[model samples]
Target: KSTVINALEDLSFYCMENLPFDLIESALDHLTREKNGPQRFAIGIDARDKRFVKEFKNLTEKLRKKFRLDVLFLSSSDEVLAERFSTTRRKHPLLDVGGELIAAIQHEINLMQPIELAADASFDTTLWSPHYLARKAEERYSGADLHRKLQVTVVSFGFKHGMLKPADTIFDVRFLRNPYFDPNLKHRTGLEPEVAAYVFEDPATDIFMEKIVDLHSFLLPAYYLEGKHYFRIGIGCTGGKHRSVALAERLVKDLAAKKIPNVELSVSHRDVMIGQGI
Candidate 1:
């Protein structure tokens, strides 16, 4: 439930966990009537109940007349599940009746087979991290508008924390002057105007920005033509608190100013507060 809930948090959907199979219709009805309520809803169900699987499918079909429905089944290898359970030191819900953990996992898998077959989409999380899984789900659930447009995510990170794997392009800003060397600006983050100004004051920063923006402007349409919907660009420096963040913000601003048709832009600072004292 946490996995599903966390993944959907970034989207506009309102989520309910551990919803009884019987109440799905009621929930949908309530959502539809509310003036300001979210049109998208994510309901979580426990797959351990074999009796509800068929009934749930029936309910989903009935609800489809009223709303768009996309059923996603999430699963993983037994070995991976076992490893997760072992690492977390938590008993499986099906561990009752004196069954071994592996047996319980197998039993649950058997019960989930019907739902898996009926699912519109399925994901195997054996090798996926939670963030990556969330990204995949978001991509899968994005509206039709997103299909026509390229969604660009510009992320700022510190090299010490490692590179962002999902990045389609990575730019290093370590060559810029270090703000950390100055006592007054050492603790400031790039979101602060002073820090941003200091970071962008270098002549090299201007040249770099122009080149990167020009490259993206040239490449974005090509990627769009190739049917690519999402692109993650990474900006990294020694500490994410300063240069990377400033550059990422500026880049997005520049891109937005260009008004690239059918392009959506977003930014995130992944490690901005890593070493902050307060």
Candidate 2:
């Protein structure tokens, strides 16, 4: 989401200053777009006859409530249009026995003024390449997961320094004794059974883990109802080598063991480099 905002801010500088200001305004308005971030939009290109252009324009306008819409109005010169229509033998929207194909195209363009003016951008397809047209459509309206599903990023960070910058909750395991002081186990990591045993054997560690687990067990369900799809829970200890790592691993295991399907869990050690047996 932040990436989208940053990209828009960077693009805003290249926009024309005198335009009706929708593009620039939309870019700037990104800051206030709310929980799901920027609104989803779509680009609509109608290649039907201008005869029904008015009706099509109205239909596209009605789509605005469902999606931010960008309409492209394509036309060609009268001579060129007539040559193509005659070659293709297609009926014109406002055609008559003596009607000019060019005139009908112009009339369609004129009738589409309301939609064009409301559009984020407009272009003449005759002058744009197919690749360029596709790119333009993408630029005006392209977003993955158009439904904007919540993005839950599972990150592992060491707690010795501080909680993660974007973390909503933090768990502390500092009460567990330091395995660094155990001469026989000092060189081992939290992944080793020796270190794990030392940490898990402590009564305080047991109580702390239970309480923290309960807290998460309570809070996660509430987040689901609030439409939150992302959350980072940080686990920290004095050095992030023993207690923190062990607790983080345990949390991951417990959550996984329960088969908590939409939730994500990961663990990382922040200060695993601290000298052993210190």
Candidate 3:
């Protein structure tokens, strides 16, 4: 619901002295409201100083009744933070207080014993960026226990890169008739419904579609067994300008028509006018 620290100085005495207290108060108030009103508990435990552990523990104890606490404790080694501070050209909290920055960090880590022991999850944030943290949080929160629908993303790409990483299966359309050779349609992408019509004019394309759809219908239930949250089926051609792109768009439409749930499909051309650098 909310976070309550010992004091602003608990993070970095030097750092907080320059920060606006109003902002901190507002954040705490927001956290409190979320915890008490919505049963949402979001708390961050950073052992920047040794004294804040008491307040952190007290806050958790008080909010246990209303909110389900998701406590995250971010830890780092003294050596790592020291190197980071040097690289960033930033002053350490204890540098001006007759204390070694490394010593202060060690002291903080030592004081985190209680919180770490009590944490639901602990992460080493020394080498992690904020983006990575957010992703980790999302992955942890996305509950897989209750009938998680298998997500399928059918992406169209170029053979130049081989395949997209998330693709569970790949289909090649390089052998099919390509629309890129047509001067009138060369500039267009697969998103235009006309492109799809032009590419699917070949009788072989029609046969291939019927088969692929049949195959996918059979494979989806099997894929669910592997705990696959998302499936990216790549369709690639030589340049991805016409065949691959058109096929991808058509695949999404067909999948929709068949009433496939948990399927989020998209089309991409890795190269459209790449040779001319357009």
In candidate 1, position 222 carries an lDDT of: 63
The residue pairs that clash in candidate 3, if any, are 1-31, 1-35, 1-41
Better of 1 and 3 by TM-score: 1
The clash number for model 1 is 0
In model 2, how large is the Cα lDDT of residue 144? 36
- What TM-score, to 2 decimals, does candidate 2 have? 0.44
Candidate 1, residue 136: the lDDT equals 87
Which candidate has the highest lDDT of all?
1
Better of 1 and 3 by lDDT: 1
Compute each candidate's TM-score over C-alphas. Answer: 0.50, 0.44, 0.47
The local lDDT score (0 to 100) that residue 245 gets in candidate 3 is 77
Please give the range of 10 consecutive residues that has the lowest summed lDDT in model 2. 13-22
Give candidate 2's error at residue 6 in angstroms: 23
Which 10-residue window in model 3 sums to the lowest lDDT?
1-10
Question: What does candidate 2's lDDT look like per residue over 1-278, in tens digits?
Answer: 12223333443312222223224345434533667554432222232333334455455444443333344444445566677668879787466623777777676556666666755445665555446655654564345324333333333345545566777887666656878778887677777777888989888877887786777767765564443556777777665567666777777676656655456656555566662323
